[model samples]
Target: MTERDFDEIAALALKHTGIVLGRHKANMVYGRIARRLRQTGYRNFADYLEYLKDNFRDESTNFINLITTNLTSFYRESHHFDFLRDTVIPELKKKSDKKVRIWSSGCSIGQEAYTIAFTLAEAHMASAFDVKILATDLDSNVVSTGAEGVYPADSLMSVPDDAVEKFFEKNRTGNQVRVKKSIRDLVHFKRLNLLEGWPMKGKFDVIFCRNVVIYFNRETQKTLFNRYADYLPVGGYLIIGHSESLNGLTDRFKSLGNTIYQKIY
Candidate 1:
């Protein structure tokens, strides 16, 4: 891929999805999207760029799918689940509405959402309330995979061992596992571009937006953090990626440590 071609692709990704791609990401971008060149029979990135200009609809979706990083697993950053099981769920249970509403923003491949599902199940919170999880990502491919609820059986290892039998059923191949219908029913996966207006209605009690904003610039992060605050009511919680912080980003939330925050009116 030529440097000029790479620059064009980078610009397209940012324009469509709000994911910032710095010079350092050039190599990673090339590695991720080279398969597109091969599949489309384009001899080089230059040829692919020409096609992308005319086929932006089909190509951009595939481009974003290929370029965006989607590294996620069940109960990734496990302690967050501990807090949910031990603290958050119990508190939400006592509320007058008897509802549990969670938004797993950037819920790649559904493991994080499933982990939320299993944790709520273990706490006996899944069926008791009108529970719902909104799992969204800009990439439609990952959203489809998440909604399908199938994964390598070994991914079950990321959560408590007991959770495997409770929430997932093995595929006929026995090498793969799919989330049980009960758990799957709890999550609703959709295609969402965070930079665009959200179509969702109503507030969320707890939002898990981990590892999603590291690719965005500060201004974008600030806007997003503020939007998150709007989606949450006073005392609602927001869980971010361990590497991310809200320090100096916004004052809408109070730090509860370990990258957790609570809305403070």
Candidate 2:
């Protein structure tokens, strides 16, 4: 691909997905876009770029799905869930009505959302509380797969044996597992581009946007956190990846242990 072709694809991605492609990322862009070219039956990269520009809506959606990286697992960063179970949930239960709302932003393939639901159900709060988890992802493919709630057995390796036996059914046909209906019903997955204005309504008691902002530029991170602050109530929890920090971003949150932040409004 020519330099101009890479620049155009990167610009289109940044415009639609808010993902910035640095100078060294040209090869990455080529590898991803090349697949899209073959899928669309385009002759070359230049033809694919032109098609994307002409057929903005459909191609843009496909491009977003192709370029977005979705790497997630059940109970990733286990400590955050532990903190939620031991600290946040107990406190919320004491002061509030038995209703809880959580937004799992950038929840790739639904593992994190399911993990949240499993934790709540294990805590025996499923029937007592009005629990709902909203999971969103930029990639349509991952969002649909997550909604299906099927996985390979390897994906359940980290899940406790009891929980796995209780919540997932093993598929004999091919090393597959399906999340039980009880757990699947608790989450709602949607396609959300974090760069655009949020369309969700109501504030959440907790928001899990872990590991997403690390791919964005610092300015994007600041804006994303500000938006998270806007959507959370005072003392609501914001759980980020362990490798991430808000140190240079904003002061609206006070650090809680285990990579969790409490909105201090």
Candidate 3:
């Protein structure tokens, strides 16, 4: 790929998905875009890019899916689940409305949302409250996968034995498992871009946007954090990836440490 081609691809990614792609990402971008070229019958980066610009309305979703990263697993960051079980759920239990909403923003392939469902079930919240988990991603492919709620058996490796037994049902081949209906019923999956408008109307009690903002530039991160704060009320929780922090970004939340923040002002 030419330097100009990479630059154009990077620019499209940033504009559509808010993901920053520096010069170092050229090799990775080349491989991904090359796959698109093969599928679209283009022979070169220049040709594909020109076609992309002309057919953007029809092709943007494929382009976004090709470039955005979706790396996630069930309970990948276990500590966040620990806090949800130990603190968040308990506090939420006291609310008179008995309704709760948790968003797994940037949720990849549904593991994080399922994990949240598992935690809530373990706490008996599903039986006691009106609970729902919204799982969203920029990639339609992953969003569909998440909606299907079926995964390889090994995806449960990090989950506790009892919880796994309770939440998932293995297939006849025993290599895959489907999230039980009881749990699947508590979550909804949709495709969303953080850079675009949100259709959700109510405030969320907890928002888990873990490991998603690291791919964005500082300005984008600042905007997203503020948007998250807007979606949450005072004392509502914002849980981010372990590698991300709110320091010097915004003051609407106070650090609860371990990458957990609560809206205070």
On lDDT, the leading prediction is: 3
List clash counts for every candidate, in order. Answer: 0, 0, 0
Runs of candidate 1 with Cα error greater than 4 angstroms are: none
For residue 118, model 2's alpha carbon misses the true position, in angstroms, by 0.7
Model 1 TM-score (2 dp) = 0.97
Question: For residues 163-204, what per-residue lDDT tens digits would candidate 2 score against the true structure?
Answer: 998889888885999999988998999998898878888899
Error of 3 at 123 (Å): 0.6
Model 2 misplaced regions, further than 4 Å: none
Model 3 residue 11 lDDT? 90
Query: lDDT tens digits, residues 1-265, model 3?
Result: 9999999999998998999999999999999999999999999999999998999999999999999888889888899999999999999999999999999999989999999999999999999999999999999999998988999888888878998889999999999999999999999999998999999999999999999999999999999999999999999999999999998899999999999999997
Report the Cα lDDT for candidate 2.
Answer: 0.88
TM-score-better candidate, 2 vs 3:
3
- Candidate 2 residue pairs in clash (backbone atoms < 3 Å): none
User: Least lDDT summed over 10 consecutive residues: which range in candidate 3?
Assistant: 151-160
Q: Alpha carbon lDDT of residue 184, candidate 1?
A: 96
- In terms of TM-score, which candidate is strongest? 3
TM-score of each: 0.97, 0.96, 0.98
